[model samples]
Target chain A: MLFRRIYQFLIVYCIGLTCLLAIKKILVLSDYVIPGIPLILDTFGQVFRGYFFDVLNTLSVTILGQIISIIMAFAVGILGRKSSWAGSFVKVMAYNIQAYPIVALAPIIFILLGDGFISRLLIASMICYFPLLLSVLGIMASPVKDIEHFYIATGRMRWQLEVKIRAFENLSKLTTVIAGSATLAMAGTIVAEFIAANAGIGYSIRIALYQSDLARILAALFMIGIVISVYQGILETLGAQLKTKWSAPKEGELL
Target chain B: MHLECDGLKYTYPGAKAAVIDNLCFTMTAPGFNAVFGPSGVGKTSLAKLLVSRGNRQESCISTFDIDTILYSYNQERLPNWSSIGSHLNKICPIGKETLKKELIEIFKLKPLLAARFSQLSMGQQNRVNLIRYLLQEFDLLILDESLANVDEALRETIILAIKTLFPGKMFLYISHNLMEVAKFCREILILGESTKQRKNFMVRGRDYTQGYTLDKKAFDATMLEIMNAF
Candidate 1:
């Protein structure tokens, strides 16, 4: 029994080692070069000392834009659901917003806000807001009938439905959508910073690319990928929980 | 309080004749009143008229008398501003908490309060649908073949539960089953037997007006035989 256990452990250990090596190789290819001890130490020092505040500044704009845009989308969606005129106007506006690449929008933001966090936030919101609205509105509109009758029968006002029923029903999808849009918003921030700001990782990446600091460039990519992955994971978990909470399974049908 | 459909009439918009012609009826309040008839008659149409709908082929007609009733409605619209939940609450007047509780316990709609309207099983959704109708106050309840969606077991269960909860409401329950109607509602209106002489009859307890359509010759023979016996 002890020998068999040892054999199983060894096999597990070998598989784990192989997978780690494979991941390490992929990371390096994707610009996460793990060099010898001295080089690793130097890279860590630079990353550790890298302006953590700058990252915070970048995320602040992203969070703000995410919140504002989502709220606006919902507001307009409510209006559109009620009136064809409002809906048409909003649809046209959404299309117009879609026409301009956000790279152009970033310059406008910088010109308007003069290199502050507000400028980046505006750019992020521009990218983040529309997608958030589109996803959530579709989600909200489709599943609305039964809930409407429910609220109507209960005599709940529009406010109660919005706050209690619609919001609760949409909690999962909205969170996941926001989470995904946040990554794109983050990507937009990087470009926007590359164009205007002096601090964020985007600016550093630009500098690294210009000066052939491939090591630092790879490191930054690694960081971005890791952050985005973590966010996506979180969003996925939230969506799964919400789906389970809110939905019923099909019954008596052949699987 | 009774639900009375005064001159309830409806037709598919483009159709030549009305599906329900000059349909006027009264259901005693808080009693099970089955709308008994064969298929393709105006039994379902009568219910649809009472419930109120949107379009010609698909609409419900609710003729509310504001003088007798207290109502708040923006008439010239298609439920645009109302979310599903809000609309439900508006018509029902019982809180969402009550719906949620009943949906969970009695209907066994536990853990599915937030699901999409389309996602539920037909029977489960049927239960939910029944809940929607019961959510609001209407002295008159009109059901148009609503029980067809559920299985026999669920049908019986739902029937009993509705009977228990809505003891004070008027029901215009439409079903094809005569026996089921006898079990629930002794009062029934069987539509579509005569073109010239439409018959009106009453059924009490297990007794049913199992009447057959008679031609002029058959009627003459039957009446002449009755006259001879007298």
Candidate 2:
């Protein structure tokens, strides 16, 4: 369980470290005449400071967007379960949304919501919505014949069945789904910022590219990695804790 | 309380013929009954109809007399024994503690309560499933092949426990095992093809013998004769 929790962080760390090393090698080989090592250190310090704030802005947007998306998905999921037609419609819409590429949709969202934080949030939420919605719906629909029978026999209301039984039964699966969607949420935020945003890691990278500042661009990339790694680490830790608390005890363990 | 279904007809969607055609039967309280049939004889369909008045998707052609019937089948949707117990408590809040303790002891479910449904052996799951429904109060309890996976000794113990603990409740024990059915159930409702080419028939307990215990070999022979004649 501990290994599973840290595996994603390890992967992100390796990727970030590799990118930083590549950037360092590039700085060493660059034709630009740096008179002393102090000059190079000063340049690196400035890039790191800028990357930190830009990545923080991006992280804030992604986290807020994901929370909104999860809540919306849950609302729709509950409504769908209550009504078969609504459920089918939501499923079809989710499928279409998932299939539609985020890159293609970002510009349209930017125009509609305007090139602001709202547009970035919208894009991130859209990217995160489908997976969370599908996971909730799938868990609800998965056949638990005995539990269904119990619900029907007891004359439980639709909402009670959804909230009390289905939700509790699928808590572990839902946690995993939310944690898994963190990366996609980050991706969506970055894409939104890249297309039209005034401040974010993606925006910083864009400015760095315009100015031909490879070191600053590298810093932005590495910071993006750090932000995602932190978000995933928190999610994974929460998921593990939930599993330990709510999961059925092992087979041999006495009740 | 009693369970009665009349003029029941069920045909699966997109099927050519009816699976259960014009089936009718009645089971009264204070009696254990067996629904005996061969494989693919719509015993399960009859059990579903008897318990829940047909699943949500199927059109309801049958008329049911009873409102609350506790049903258990071999295919479990239980996550774990603990949840199952908790659900039973939630459903039947009255006498929850006593019933849970009684059922746990009778079914020997204490050790298996913490294990997930999938982690337990099939026999363990079957016992757990039976105990889950037995916890609830209903006018009629339908056991649809619920004990098929259990061993002979455990099956006898469960049947005895049900008879001893829940004497007032009506039980419809559906199984292909005629001997086990004859052992516990005084009434037998055999669903088979009729002489007039009808797909279903209902036979009463008195037709064989109006008694709880039966001669095992003789009962098997009689059941075979009835099946062959059908």
Specify the highest-DockQ model's number. 2
lDDT of 1 by residue, B137-223 (tens): 555565656666577766766666777776666666777765466555646665663242552233432312223232546445433
Measured against the native two-chain assembly using Cα atoms, what DockQ does each of the candidate structures obtain, in the order listed?
Answer: 0.11, 0.32
lDDT of 2 by residue, A147-184 (tens): 67755665654665546567667777787789878888
TM-score of each: 0.61, 0.78
B38-97 per-residue lDDT for model 2 (tens digits): 777778887776665655455443333445677788876664424544544555567667
Where in model 1 is the C-alpha error above 4 Å? A1-57, A153-157, A238-255, B1-31, B36-46, B53-136, B144-169, B187-230
Question: How many clashes show up in model 2?
Answer: 0
| Candidate 1 lDDT over residue span A14-111, tens digit each | 57545645776777643234343355447646874473455555666666777787788787665544436776677667667766676766776788
Largest TM-score belongs to which candidate?
A: 2
Predicted complex 1: DockQ = 0.11
True contacts kept of 2: 0.36
